[model samples]
Target: MSTPDTVTVDGPGLRDDPSRPGPVDVPALLAHSRETVGPALRAAVARLDVSSREQAEYHLGWVEADGSPGRGGGKAVRPALALLSAAAAGAPAETGLAGAVAVELVHNFSLVHDDLMDGDRERRHRPTVWARWGAASAILCGDGLLTLATEVLLEDRSPHAAAAARLVAVTTRELIRGQAEDVAFERRADVGVDECLTMAAGKTGSLLATSAAIGAVLAGAPTAAVRGLSDYGMAVGMAFQLVDDLLGIWGDPAVTGKPVLSDLRSRKKSLPVTFAVQRGGAAGRELAAWLAHTGEQTDAELRAAADLVERGGGREWAGAEARRRMVAAERALAGAGLAAGPHAELLALGHHLIDREF
Candidate 1:
């Protein structure tokens, strides 16, 4: 969602050299991800019945059995990170393809169940799997994907397979726990900023850490370097969630592909709103009154709530926090001592995440 920051680099830097080009093209990265992962996913889905498999493939934006292309695939950022990290760590990029695919499959599995639990009707501008096929079917499909992800990891015979397995298992549990905490926060009036950050780290950060760790492992990087990449991923992931919280309140529907004020309408305990509530002033009191009101909020009420969040300095605080995390991520990447180009790209990506408007 974020754009790249402009840097006045001397000679040889990404923006300075006319021949070196600018930031990585996200669409090209996505295309590479699809080329590497798509066939394997299709093969895994072949074990299912025609209807179930069709539905699963549709969710992935693959062709149905009838060979018609489906809709709504995502940007594949996780897999791209995995593959890029591998390359940055000195292995052939293709060496990490299996790990990339596995991580992405697990991510999609979680997303399917998450949409069901949240009763979200749409994803990637299309009806969610649960919305189209029913909760039972969606659950089964998600489970199947999870199983396949583990199988893919096993098939790769990674030297650090045990560690990768442990990471995924732990990440999955934390994901559930974070989601539960999020749901619980919706009913409570006193959600703390620290608690919200903890939930965000567990839910969004853990898997990203795993993605980078797995890539480093596959590349046979030293333990210290692997750990550094994991830490970098965690920091970047937190920054991403903070930016997402900002977008949930202020982003254009066209850019985010979601309705404006949707998080407010759902009464989500996002960082900005929670901070505003904790500030406890005129804005906080007005927000509390709105929360207690029996009726649903009109557009004006939602706008007022957003204004309260902004006035309370929640947005500013979150933006600063995201920037801080980006700095931490850059330090971690430097600690890993990876090649200059990929490190530059990763730093650019981190800046983009923190600075994005949508």
Candidate 2:
């Protein structure tokens, strides 16, 4: 949330032409998005019963477990993307505020449930809703958030609201499917990189795709342009997950709010891990054997496993793939006919997100 502004956009985009956009302040864009949609998001959550409201507020980083005031939510990237989509269509950013709130709601809803399902005890350096409260409470809270997401959009009187709501529903289904696949992968050692990439496309890409295009739907942008933005969002989402997979293995706990090599410790068949295992070399075999073992790994073992993943080319592959996806995102944006400023903003954001470090 405290990230700096002034992101220099990489990747080929409309900015390549001398008459087009300049550097975008991604942090300012994100901050403006938060200012635009955070209240709507909170007000929507306020509709939940008190029991659910407290848990929602806590999990949303609005308060501490003891109900004390606190400040920390994610970078609010989804909402930012939604609002930017509308701007790209030459509409008032406010036209996309509902879409922004709805996507943010669904995102947080998934986070609550995902934390419970993954047995993750911490988020944003605080105890997760399930860990601090109870699993039952966490489930109900997630349900409340998910329901509110649709309700918020449906409450809008815009002619396009229904279509946007429907899109959110469909995208949420894909997200759930991807999550299921991710969970199932834990029980099998035969997960392939292609399969893992497909899973990431669903789990992460679908929602982002919606976030990118839903604003256009709400603003009634041309169908082809909306489709282009959706395509751009998909590529950006894949890049994001690849970077996440890398962070899961090598992120700084002080920044990521999780232990180092956390995914390896859990034996998570992440994209990079899957790629490395499928690479089939000495390092790959060692990594596969380590993953197959059903015992808690030592600190040394975790570090060594991280090395094996790198040696097996998982780290390099993930990094290169992330860059490739960024390029794809830019290409999609170039043909989208988006307004120059918004197009520039979107491209800068994609770069900033995929290039993010923990």
Candidate 3:
């Protein structure tokens, strides 16, 4: 974990930090978010059919594949976003608890379905929901989560309840659209940069944007403040996905908890890969040929493909683009009118999102 006084990345966009007492402690914030959101998810799942409930619980890491107690989960970024956004809007963080749980449920809903669609056998170093519970159960579990996300919001009975639910629904639709495009891209050989960016914004950016905005809306923030939070989330979300794409090619398997070149192995059309192809250089040509092959690539071939991606400037371009997005995020956050504490925490969180190793 990075200390508040940690010397972070310095560039045109990222502001220098002297010391902070809030969002710099990412691990602590994540733990706090999980504590708030986890029980809500568990209770919601408990209301479902017994078998489906078990599957959902397993997927959520509340239990093992064999129904034993276990501990495993994501970094809780979405929940933290909701809580922080509420604080930024001058509301108590507890007021956003429902919003945070809804966002976490929706996020896990996407994960369950994505694993099935991608034929991914593992997630968080465990067998994926589909891999362990079968496709039917996995699909049901995902449906259950989506239902719970809306149900939690509807149960709130607050003035912004309907609006928040609407936001989540709209974002979920975009997510589905992005997933459709991603599947279609796998079958085509000519995916362009613009299309890839659109897909990324929908699949990854929309939920995160909504996550950051919902808390503000629930807190009855002014319209401009809510919009600012939304824009900040969108920018950070794009930057986050870009970093993820970079890590897919070059990150250590131990740190990422995945196989080497996992994205390449899956033939994912990640941002860096798109940039490499768009460059149309010798390295791009070489990479295009490797991408054309349908057979499973050897480890050596995967290494060569990664080399081509980096040599073609994909790595540098993505890093720069991410930093630019970070700058955009900072600008939007500045307009959110948050108190110093929330604003500083959000800035730190934004920097952490871009500068993380895994």
User: Per-residue alpha-carbon lDDT of model 1 for 1-358, expressed as tens digits?
Assistant: 2446543222122222324645564455456666776776678777766766777787887754356776547767777677767766867666677778778888888888889998989877678889988999899988887887777767776687656666677877887788898888778877888999999988899888877667778878888878888898899999989889988988888877668987787777788777777774778767766665655889898898889888877788888888788778878988997766556655655565566665
Error of model 3, residue 317, in angstroms: 1.0
Q: Root-mean-square deviation of each candidate, in angstroms?
A: 3.5, 4.1, 4.4
Question: How well does model 1 score by local distance difference test?
Answer: 0.75
Q: How far off is residue 134 in model 2, in Å? A: 1.2
For model 3, residues 80-125, the per-residue Cα lDDT tens digits are 8887788788887766777888888899899999999989898887
Residue pairs with backbone overlap in model 1: 2-356
Clashing pairs in model 2, backbone N/Cα/C closer than 3 A: none
lDDT of 2 by residue, 1-358 (tens): 1223454543222222424445676676787778888889989999999988999998888888676786868889999899889878878667888999999999999999999999989887789989988999999999999999999999987799999999999999999999999898878889889989989998999999999888888999998889989999999999889989899999987766678888898888998898899994999999999888887778998999999999999999998998888888889989989877777778778777876574
lDDT of each structure? 0.75, 0.86, 0.81
Candidate 3 ranges with C-alpha deviation above 4 Å? 1-23
TM-score winner, 1 or 2:
2
Alpha-carbon TM-score of each model against the true structure: 0.89, 0.92, 0.92
Stretch of 10 with least lDDT, candidate 3: 9-18
